[model samples]
Target: MTTHANKKTALVTGANKGIGKAIAAGLARDGFTVFLGARDSEKGHAAAAELKAEGDVRFVLLDVTDSASVQSAREAIESETDRLDVLVNNAGIASAPGSRFKEPAEEIAASMRIVYETNVFAVVAVTNAFMPLLLRSDAGRIVNVTSKRGSIGEEGAWVGRPNMTYSSSKTALNAITAHYARSLSATNIKVNGAAPGHVATDFNGFRGTRTPDKGAEVAIRLAQLGKDGPTGVVFEDDQQLAW
Candidate 1:
């Protein structure tokens, strides 16, 4: 097994494409040995290969919804490093592609399980599985990549197509983030949420005005937060987003 005890390391889930890819690239550039956690082996490898120019980037198979996959990912990561400095739970769906706001009410209801499974449930499983490694770090950081629509406190949240499942899932994720921060308050680990404003990615059918790189800025920033930085808060860029 390889040892990365002297080097900082990070893992970004759903990193084969979109904002997750950008986050992996940014972390790699920032000198962290980045692990691109993706379900698709081919795409994951391809993404890691492309990000090679940035710095040390590798691919790990991670289907967050599956308990076995999560366990395998943890083992794979543990094989390389004794500690995980950063964890970016970026794998999420704002409704399946092309079906956005078009699915029947019953269908949308059925899809809620899948949505929560990915955006909310998976975050808990993956974080818990990796928490041991994170605890070993001198300063571990967790960045939950949520969405602005999750902000029930914002007026815009109700203005959109009213994707109840997706929006509510994010809200649930935000609560989980806060609970994690509260639980780990006395530890060296810092937990926070990042609402990367909508960006032009396949998730939104490319309707966003921002680029993937632009969307990734907040998450990458949160992942590298200083020891004195605030925890249990969600930020979009430098501004805090409502819960």
Candidate 2:
């Protein structure tokens, strides 16, 4: 295993493409030894290779929906470094855009479960597995990539929208972020949620108005926060957002 005693190390899940990829690249460019976590080994390696010019980047296979995979990823990182300075839980899934909401209760429940497996439950599993390593860092940072639609305060805007699974999963993620931030308040760790507004990505059928790089700015900034940075907050661009 190779070690970088002088540089901070970061792990970003779902980093093979889209906003996660942009976050990995941004961290690597900032002199972090970034671990690009992807479920697909081929894509993970490809992304790491693509970012080699930026800094020390490597691929780590991580399937957030699987407990075994999450544990294995934690072990893999532990083998390389004793501490993880940053963790970006960016893996998430959404039901097909513009698809009709299932009329049957069973179908809706299944859809919600599928999305939650990746967005909500996986975040909890992955964070718990890496908590020890994060605590070892001098300035640990956890950034949960969330969405503005998760805001219950904004329900009026999406009252009739067909995004139950995706939006509610984000709401759960925001809550999870708050829970961790408060739990770890006495420590050096900072846990926060980031809303990447309307990014054009495969997840949304490439229909959003912003680019992935622009969407990743807030997450990258939060990841690099100092010891004095705020914890348990949701941020979009540079502004604090409502829970």
Candidate 3:
């Protein structure tokens, strides 16, 4: 029955490892009570324990792909605090490289469904479910972890990039971010998309040049934005990119 009434609170999905865990750790270090949400209880608790020395950190079971799980997590948070200052949608999945382009049509569709289920649909579900709590905060923020490859404005650069499923899902996520930001413009909440660039994680088979800690930087920055910060934009590090 620990209370987080005096501090800002944040929830980072898929926070058991990788970028999600890094973001949770960063938020905790910034004096926010961070809920490390992970589908697996063991991993989630382990991550929370590892970050215990950093600051206030807790573990919450959250499966972004499941509506029931999402609601339960929301209720769990509500039971602890009336407001959610930050919500980081960091849970995502990608088909093995080249699978989208080399697989059969049916296989490609199935893969797309899997990616969209977590990347796009789950983001909408989680954000919508937590909107009430976000609105209650003094400086609410929503950070959708997206990718530069999802930008249609840069389509020419992706000529041979084998990321049809993953890329398109992020594109949809960016759209969701814009839609939410517009819808909540009159309110105090700020919603934006964050591109972490290519980070070395299990999602990309550890081939990326940067580390998960580096990827979490943008999302952490977005999460800590003040009331005056810009909204409805896609940012990479500190630079705003075309949406």
TM-score of each: 0.95, 0.94, 0.94
Q: 52-163 in candidate 1: lDDT tens per residue? A: 9999999999999999999999999998888999999999977644454643354666678878999999999999999999999999999999887787865545765666
Note the residue pairs that clash in candidate 2: none
Error of 1 at 28 (Å): 0.4
lDDT: worst 10-residue window of model 3: 96-105
Which order, best to worst by lDDT?
2, 1, 3
Q: Which ten residues in a row have the lowest lDDT in candidate 1?
A: 96-105
- CA lDDT scores, all candidates in order: 0.89, 0.90, 0.88
Assess the local accuracy of residue 62 in candidate 1 as a C-alpha lDDT between 0 and 100. 100
lDDT of 2 by residue, 34-129 (tens): 999999999899989998998889999999989999999999999999899999999998763344556335355666777888999999999999
The candidate scoring highest on lDDT is 2
User: lDDT by residue for model 3 over 1-243, one digit each (tens)?
Assistant: 555577999999999999999999999999999989999999899999999998989999999999999999999999998899999999988763356354233455766787799999999999999999999998999999998888877541354555566677888988889989999999999999999988999887799999888999999999988878999999999989885
Decreasing TM-score order of the candidates = 1, 2, 3
**Highest TM-score against the true fold, candidate:** 1
